[model samples]
Target: MRLLITGGAGFIGANFVHSSVRVHPEDSLTVLDAMTYAGSRESLAAVENDIRLVQGDITDAELANKLVAESDAVVHFAAETHVDNALADPEPFLRANVIGTFTVLEAVRAHGVRLHHVSTDEVYGDLELGNARRFTESTPYNPSSPYSSTKAASDMLVRAWVRSYGVRATISNCSNNYGPYQHVEKFIPRQITNVLTGRRPKLYGSGTNVRDWIHVDDHNSAVRRILADGQIGRTYLIGAEEERDNLSVMRAILRLMDRDPDDFDHVADRAGHDLRYAIDPSALYDELGWAPKHTDFEDGLRATIDWYRDNETWWGPLKDATEAKYEGRGQ
Candidate 1:
């Protein structure tokens, strides 16, 4: 299959590209990325010789149509994903998440190409700290942040296209992902990098907020399954059932790096921060027989720490810039 993956140079997308190239030798891939700050060529360096990289925006109608016209399937992963950045400036999120998705949907519709839309669990808002309820495919949309709201809008556009225009499309809403190649601005990497650089990890508020963590490779595996055999117009929730609070995650990272568990600072909490996000991926597991290989959070974190420690060349250039951005925000 010839696959066109948008945002293929970004964290999750690049991981997907690597997984595809390594696991599916018969498939060919063309990655369409805008080369934004979060998206880097280095992320795809390992698979650069194996896949085609197109430095273009998803909002470009002509480019999107041209790429989709020639591909067997489209995996839409491009977006303005940082919630903190969205809180400060939402215009980019709207343009990249909403309009970008519309452009992809139109191209897929015109060419009759199958599409898999990658989304986040934040679209369903947050669950209470102690609530037993987990987000399912049937959860109602209640996005709190600009980033999530735009993603929710994009998800709706895909559904609209599928129902109103009969576009072959599937959507997957996944939880927080951590693994190698993730940007340092995110929570896990930020803490890991901080410890590596001899700085204390920083937590927000009381660090009580919880998230369902999934390994990036596991997420990519589920995406592949959905792209190959999922029902059109259906939504799948992808998670590994590894739920941990922010403080716990910080302690685990510190322990892995041989730092004190309490060796961290508490910054101001994010505005409109969601309390918890847990995904119920039973439908994906039961119907598609998809199961996560990285169910142990600490084991995954140790592997991720090892990767960052061993591959400073890959993440070093962007570390100072990412930390500078966060420092300016007082986070």
Candidate 2:
């Protein structure tokens, strides 16, 4: 099958590219990305020759139509994904998440191609303490932050296209993903890099914010399975069923690095911080036989720490920029 993956150079996108090329060598995988700072080309360095990559923004309808016209499926993974960045400025978020998704939906409709959209559980917003409302395929969205609000909007647009235009589409909303090649700005990488370099790990609020953590590799597998066998017009939530508070995750990282727990720097919480988010992947597991296969959080943390330490050059630039930004250099 011929596949077109937008934002294939970004963290999870790049991982999917590699996963596709290796697992489905007979399939054609072409990537379209604008090469934004968060979308690093180096992530695809190893598989550069195995797949076709087009550097362009998904907002360009002409380009989107052209790419979708040639592919049997389009996995839309490109978006402005940083929460803080979205809080600071939302225009780019609209252009990337909302406008880009609209353009992608239109292009796929024009081409009569199937679309698989990648989304986050954050769109469901904060979970009340001890309350069990794991996001299901039918959960109502209540986005709290700018980033999630835009994603929720994009999700609505995808659903509209699927229902109104008869466009075949499958959407997957995943939990927090952490593994290799993730941009350093994310929670896992930021904490890992910070503690490894003998710096304090920053904890937002009391760090009690809960997240369902999943290994990126496991996530990639779930997406591939969904693309291969998932029913159309369905939204699947792929979760590892491992929920941990933000502080617990941080301490796991510190322990993995053999660092002191006091290295965690307690910081003031950001506006509209979600208290928790948990997802139940029962639908995906029961229908598609998709269940996560990864080490426990501790094991995964150790392996991830080793990766960041060994691949310094790969993550070095991003780590340096993150430090510089903290020092008030780049704006």
Highest TM-score, which number?
1
User: For residues 1-331, could you state the per-residue lDDT of candidate 2 as single tens digits?
Assistant: 9999999999999988988888899999999999988987788999988889899998999999999999999999999998978887889999999999999999999889989999999998878867777778777899998899999999999989999999999999999998899988888898888876777788888887898999998998999999889998899999999999988888888777877765777776777888888999999999999888885888887888999999888887778778776545222
* TM-score of every candidate relative to the true structure: 0.99, 0.96
Q: After superposition, how far is residue 197 of candidate 1 from its true place, in Å?
A: 1.1
Which stretch of 10 consecutive residues in model 2 shows the poorest summed lDDT?
Answer: 322-331
What is the TM-score of candidate 2?
0.96
Candidate 1, residue 285: lDDT:
96
Residue 144 error for model 1, in Å? 0.4
Q: Which residue runs of candidate 1 sit more than 4 Å off their true CA positions?
A: none
